[model samples]
Target: MNRIKTDWTKPQKLSLVALLFIIGKTIKESWVLILYFIVRAFVKQNEDEDDTEKRSDKLIYFLLLTAAFLIFFQIQKFIQFFKTRIYIKDNELIEQTGIFTKKTKTIPIHKIQSVHLVQNYIHRFTDTCTMKVETAGTEKTELELSAIDYLKAQDLQEILQQKEAVSAANISDNNSTQLMGLSNFDLIKLAISENHIRTLSLIFAFAMSRLDDLRQFFGKKTDAIIDEQVNQINFTTSIVAGMIGLGIAITLAFSVIRVLLRYNDMQLTANQKGFKVKWGFLQTQQKMMLQNKVQLISWNSNFVRKLLGIKILRFFMVGENILKDDQYIKLPVLQEDVLKKLSAYYQPVWPSLNENPNYTHPSYAWRVTMIYILPVAFAASVALYFWEPWVMIIPILLFLYFLVTFKIRHMKFIFWYNQTSLQIQKGIWGDEHILLNFKKVQHVALETSPFLRRKNLATLVLHTAGDSIKIPYIPLTKAQAIADRCLYEIELDKS
Candidate 1:
């Protein structure tokens, strides 16, 4: 450590755009203190002030304190940013951070799982992007270069991608292919056909959660405030209908806007290294994952998508990645033929869709009915006895829904496996098909309760690095056979 003379490149490596992030972080971290001071200053000034000079003096003091607090944090962050350095040295991506307590991190190029370059609305105008580097064992992005030149980011991504490809191989690791991209008309269609119901439900949930938050502030008065607001609205048929229409219109508008913003100019590409997905309008994102790291591939379609011959595809990569609940990449496939090609690329020897899958036991239907429908019906009936007849409507509707969907949900729960891969098909209105390479199976679990054992049925759970697929209410023999086959494939892969 004798004064290592190397090109550190801290000045060129840093971006002024990162000051925006630094300011945002400072505000986020110090918001409570900021708010507390402002509120205190206001309250003190308003407390029956006798002299204008005293009130002005108190206000000035408080303002000075707040400004000094914020300025101190801002200066600290600026200093840290100035001191931070990242560079490539000896086949490793190195980052040195911190001013007082210095730290250095070296990540081998081969260990990099993904490198994402993102440009939000602000970054786009600045010609800079945030590059996030993720590794296998880490739960979140391990290294994030707040802002870098777009060309420099691309070069870094290429170098990392080339390094990753050296150790990873896929079936179609040959030519660079533009698998799919959304056209203008297709983007409009996707936006229009977006699931407004799901969006509305999310909006509703968020509103309700906020209401609970309001309850914390308002105490018992929260309900009274809501009731007071509700009472002002005249409940005429026309008014009710207009409100419903307005809600639907709002939901549709929100969905369309969200879909457009998220998927505008979306493109999916395949290369010798892996797959890359680029999308978003206001905030552009480019994610690259290695082909060999993919453990499971799935595609699903709602009723609208099915009618339109469109499906949403998802790739599940290997690792203990728990951060992908909402962050998972979703690629839209417009053509069934394209989907087939993608599937073939992932699993060359997949089981045919026409093959008769091992369906769940017939008892699954009754068991579901007993577990779900009966309790709901009983609870509804009890509520009807205690309350008004209107209460029965919800339960009655739920019961009817269960009755209508019981057969499809239970009887259609089927799975088929070949020597190389396993495919599970399950859903009620929509169809979700998950394909897993047998060699990727990390473990097999066969679970049975006393009731299931008595009925000679067991649940087979195939655990992979990405997720778990549970095939329940199948014959014990079939369950065991599938587990055994998966273990055999796993051992074969090891060999």
Candidate 2:
């Protein structure tokens, strides 16, 4: 095996990629100032004035000011890059940073929750990656090496993983087991089945935001430009249909391209220590998660994926929420057998819905309708009456939609628990399953409102390190018993 001969104990500077990273960071951080300068130079200019010399002088002054501002920031970042140093010693990761004011941070090795290696296009070209270290209880990345050697980053991550294993007292052998990998055909299938409507909505939202920005610059003239463009378009039924088809085609193409780039060459593996997922085409990312640190495991499938026999599996480690889709660890389960095998590794005994499962109270449907649908219906009735009475039909349709769906939603909801774990089955058209270990429950609470109290029902909430699960509108006695059992299991785990 080939190994790099760099000592991690001694302080070391970042890779040369840091120069590019620093430049990019400076530009991103100063974008608002850049925008302000551009707006001032354009909006404040007196184009109608005949005094050419005065305008020339003003332009020169603006150029010099912008140049000086950018130069100052560049110098500051350069100095910061030179001064920053990092090293691992005495079971702690230490970093020293800052140009004028010095600051240092130390994180214990055992406290690290995960180590992520990210390689964007620039880093890929330079054969480097960013190393992000996250510790338990921190809301954000605790330490980041903006640029480091890709191979060295993996070695350092393994070292940290070993330290975590020792702390947990559950070290395993050096054999890695491959859990999942995607082929080119599988990637095509995955891309084809993705929700293209969501992608189209995102694209439409971005276009609208850009239009608002244009409105700020052009004032009322922006609307004039839009109207002029619309007038120029020869809108026939065929043309309108062609445009809609073209838009759909473009959205699907974009989605396919995006999925291919982001999830190309994906692999998931597990060992005694933990799980590691590697994926990407241009910008590769590797996520390492410890076995014992994973607090919640969930698998959700939409209508399309359900037909394809696929589901997206997510692992929620300590201190992680619903982060950027790319940041959190997720895998596409292609088969039920694969999902069962992976589930067995994380949770030995996956609970099934009982023949007579604990369903929500009979009032669940009506209560959900009153809480969610009534307010919107009432607001729409008031607003639409003053605007367009005909539009009131929309709110009526929406109310009926929710009223029917909530009844099916309540029927679909099931909560099952055993001595060791809790299983929640939820959703209307699609199936979503969540598994939580009793030991992972950090807090349990029983909640009731006047309505619930009158019906002898309460809501039980179980809070874990990464996520929370709520069993709403259950019998008060059952809710209390569930809470007490969770607390007892947590205390037993401590012993």
Question: Against the true structure, whose TM-score is highest?
Answer: 2
> How close to the true structure is residue 163 of candidate 1, measured as C-alpha lDDT?
61
Q: What is the C-alpha lDDT of each candidate?
A: 0.80, 0.84
lDDT of 2: 0.84
- Give one digit per residue, the lDDT tens place, for model 1 in 1-495: 553333333223568888889988888877876887678658854446568778766876887798787888689778878877788766688887788889898998777777888998778889999998887766778888888777777767866776667745423244778888888888777876788878999989999999999999889999998899999988999998999999988898888888888788888877757888898887899988777677889999888888887899888876646566434687888997778777665786557555566788887777777787879897877789678876777777777778768878886677887767788888889889898888889999999999899999998899987789898889899888888999998888789
Q: Which one is best on lDDT?
A: 2
Tell me how far candidate 2 lies from the true structure as C-alpha RMSD in angstroms: 4.0
Query: In model 1, which residue pairs have backbone atoms overlapping below 3 Å?
Result: none
Question: CA shift at 412, candidate 2, in angstroms?
Answer: 0.9
In angstroms, the error of model 1 at 257 is 0.4
Model 2 residue 84 CA deviation (Å) reads 2.9
Model 1, 310: alpha-carbon shift in Å? 1.4
